[model samples]
Target: MPYAPSTVNQEQSRANEGPEAVRAAVGRARDAAPAWDALGHRERGARLLRWRRVMARRMDEIVALLESEAGKVRADALVELAAAFEHLGWAARHAGPVLRRRTVRSGPLMFHQRSTVEYRPYGVVGVIGPWNYPVHTPLGSVSYALAAGNAVVLKPSEHTPGTGRWLAETFAEAVPDMPVLGVVTGDGGTGAALCGAGVDKVAFTGSPGTGARVLAACAPSLTPVLLELGGKDALVVAGDADVEAAVEAALWGGCANAGQSCAGIERVYVAEGVYERFLDRITLRAPEITGGPGGDYGRMTVPAQLDVVRRHIDDALARGARAVVGGPGSVVPPYVTGPVVLADVPEDADAVREETFGPVLVVNRVRDAEEGVARANASAYGLGGAVFARRGGVRLAREMRTGMVSVNDALAFTAVGALPFGGRGRSGFGRIHGADGLREFAAPQAVTRRRFAPPLAIQTFARGPRDLARFERLLRRRGY
Candidate 1:
């Protein structure tokens, strides 16, 4: 069947101006940063809260925009919007304490003086977000940056320009007088310009390949960056795992958002004893999941990704793997590929190695829990992993090389508002969400004010022999 070309224009043919326009937006953001940053946290928080209300009131409009641009189900679009709203609330409520100066206990000698650390905002932050979870990912950066007192210039993925437009419109309603946030929509050139446009920092979310380019662009400016990149996360099913529970988790974790999520599980390593049964159950249910704007799944957001999905499927079949449920023919066209489960896929196969950013899963048997852990860790991308062990969920989760691990459940690590969210190695670095997210846009400044003179001078030209002997003895006793 012929596929429906993505409603979104990938070349950003429909998107307004390329790099030059984005550069101008960045200039405006940089010009407005000082005034925005000078506002008190309470005032800033009120403006953010107003935006939050705007998001709540216009949920339907936002959802519709999201569906057209991203091709995700209406409910799924709402879910992303809700998550973005939550982060906005979280940042606004917590920013004051998180960024305020706090007294630090100085050791004995320094106790005579008072010391504290305060966090200051970077001037401007450029946020480059992905098409998948467009609202949540971009707002994750935008909200935190605003709460930390920095002006933000956002570049939503070319495939999801409408979502970006909604976000900017909402903010404009909340803080009409303040140029707190701006949006620039385009393809790679706009994103590249944002990185090099004299922004104090950059926050990017997308594939690792694109992340590499973002890193290189920011390197020349020595600008710090927070990258939330791709992952080929794994789900490790230990021998002790409940078969029904593990299967349910693996299916949803791998297929949710049509498997477009960076933290979604693409690989499943089950213990040898239950491997066959697990694969059978998952494959059996894969086809029933459905895909469309009205259904649970939806059309592919990027038309080119359909080709990538097909290629991964073809590669797996050529490597002797069989799709127990959906095959190439099962790839329901018009930008909607139904769920597919592949068994006997070699570890080295492209399907298993690359991020098949579609509803596809690769199942492999492991000798034991040890093998399951090893296979999960073997991937170059260590963004996230899941463990379904009955007695050792926490321990097994800790052992995974990824930055986050879900125990007894898939994607649970993301809902916790307290945990820092990020990945390592090829999955990318820096964080969003939790306390770390708040700190990402701010720099810590340590202040120490001298009070009275010390009994023995350390930094004076009139230091005596007794003072020198005392310092040496203290150092010797502490083994310094």
Candidate 2:
């Protein structure tokens, strides 16, 4: 469906947000960058603290908008909102230390000099957010960017534009004078414009195809980008594991956010010993799901996504797969897509191979833990995975070719606050959360101060023969 520009309400989005407005916003941010960066970390953190308080007070409003736009449940929407607050708090408290200069010891001959590295904020950051978990994902970039002293131009997903508006309005309440952070709303064109808007960097969260486009637009200007793309994450259940626990973990991991999460579990390889048991439990729980207004499940946010879900189901059924919960034509009232559990699915089916960002979970049996791990790793995405091995859960988690792995729980790494969240290969590169997130928006500057000139003065143009002899002796002592 084409996005009708007339339906876009400027008041609901923001005043002055057309192409010309976006250019102006970028210009304003660029002009404000030096002043914002000049504010030491402590001063910048005060603004973030005010924003955090605003988020806490108005969380219900945020959650309601999230549900209406993204078609998520109230509880799930709150989960997203709460995580955003926590992330903001973490960024505010830690950005100072993480970005502060730290002295590094200079060895021997250069010992008289003190070396340190300081992190400098990028001039301006362009953010492109997605519809799924709109607040949580975008705040990861926005909070870090702000804490690191970069002005931000955020372009939220077209599907959930209202949520973005709400966030921008809330922040405005806290920071009234400085338009340091501004929001732009539109279809892909606006995003393309932002990518080429001459911002120092761009942070985008979306599908692989769109991620590619964002990168291509940045190439001409040599602009840097952080792309958090798609994932076909897998779950491995080893033999002798707690079958019930594994099934529950898989259900939440696969169906949470209607399976729209980049880290949502899409595939499962179960060891032969517990395959049937796990399937039975998941089948029992899956059908009880309902989607609609005030329902457990919600319709896919993007209308085009429904077709993708249907196609994956059709491909599996045509290949002789049995649906333990929902069939191809299954539907519910309102916004719910309903939950689906497919068992005995062929490994090669589209449902197993591609990312069905819907309430669908595929289960296949494997010979052993090694086989399960092998099957889980056989994907183009390595964003997040899960393992339910009794004896070697940590070991198995370490072996998964993804950035994050939950041993007994599902998607718990995101809550840890200290663990870095990112992915490998097709899931995209770079990280958010923990110390890495603070560094993402800042550039490193190495500093060195010479307390006194060395007696030999080897760095000068007047280096003598005695310095060369001393350097050779040092290298020989170090076994070089």
Candidate 3:
């Protein structure tokens, strides 16, 4: 299969090597896991820090590759690179404290016992990452997995195999001994092979439908999986919100990355009191956004997705939704499609219900903040969202059902390294950031020890009726 950069002028191709290559890579990862884990947290962290330095030195090259392969604008590519860098650094710096053994109370019933919990590696991890935010998305899992002392085998999207290979190469440059990270380039079949290759666990980022297939692939081994799937994320604009700021956010959040982001704003629910004003502001700003090479946004990375985008727009328009900016005619063939803003779109319309992975936004007026929150939550997805309100931002945010919500801002929660990122319902389960992400790649092992033997020996068969009576008395006193 041939692959081309966003410009479509230059094309390159790679054959899908199938299952054999995937198994070989996974075997190497399995062999390397023990030595990598044996390095301990400090040495592992130091190696990761060196990897970060290498990434820093190669940021420009990585960004260029992202733009060519993922159809991302320079600014957007830089943003993705920066986020990946932050996650890598944060994972290295905080892994020791987050995964270290910690003492827990033994409780009154077992006062003589001491208990502790430690996080241990899961051997090897299989990461199946998406094309959009390819570097950042996979690294979020890979970095944390490495910091937690697990070897990683990554199968990046077919649209971005080069980016994946670059990452593995740079990692090798930093730590030459042992294959701490491995890359297997192929299509979906290779990804499936990795899932069933007996990797300790799998971390997948893609659509919910694909996520289900991945789940099935890992079923026989009962391998645990962490899924970060698609989202039809909503943006709620309260009556008291700053209409201008909200519109600005809608423009960037909805159109950035050519709207391929899983957490990108797909639907906007504005309180009726400020609906017209919000629309006016967005209309004024929408004209400035463009899509092409070296434009505000780039072409759709995946060619098949263009049909889905077109169908969503056409369906909404035929159903009486009016476009305030781009309409059906804005599609520039092959891949490029500018931002489209639709008003009065039905809640059941595909544009609102399904994830329209394109530069499109659907706006619906709500009766009040209560109605806005209700409309936003009335979806199968509960991923990321935004609530723009001055006085009630936090209150309204708490009412939303998504995993992460930015108050008075869009996509801000993802920039901070400490916050956990994931979703519920069809948006998928598990997390891949912060302390929770580090623990996701690890298995928690609990240890308990007796400080001193109890006077009544419950374990010994020698103790008969008197020992049983004493144990019962202790239970009764503790109200167990």
**TM-scores vs. true structure, each candidate:** 0.94, 0.95, 0.96
Local lDDT at 74 for model 2: 82
Residue pairs whose backbone atoms clash in candidate 2:
291-336, 299-335
Winning model by TM-score: 3
Model with the higher lDDT, candidate 1 or 3: 3
| lDDT, candidate 2, at 67 | 67
Off by over 4 Å in 1: 1-20
Per residue, candidate 1 scores C-alpha lDDT tens digits across 1-480 of 211223334344347666778788888988888888888677788889989998799777777777777777866776677677778888888889889889999887677788999889998899998998988888888998999999999988877776777788778877998886988888898899888888999999998889999999999989998999989999999888998899888888888788888999889999998898888788677777877635677887887888888999999999999888788874665554567888889999988888988888888899987788888888899899899988887887888899999988998877665667899988999999878998999999999988888887866879988899998888788776
Tell me the TM-score of model 1: 0.94
For model 2, what is the error of residue 292's alpha carbon versus the real structure, in angstroms, after optimal superposition?
Answer: 2.0
Model 1, position 51, has a per-residue lDDT of: 91
Candidate 1 deviation (Cα RMSD): 3.5
- Candidate 3 per-residue C-alpha lDDT over 392-435 given as tens digits, one digit per residue, 9 for 90 to 100: 89999999899999998899988788889999999999999899
In model 2, the worst 10-residue window by lDDT is 1-10
Candidate 2, 202-299: lDDT as tens digits: 99998889999999999999999998888988889999788899988888898888778889988888999989888888888776766666667566
Ranking by lDDT: 3, 1, 2
Estimate every model's Cα lDDT from 0 to 1: 0.84, 0.83, 0.89
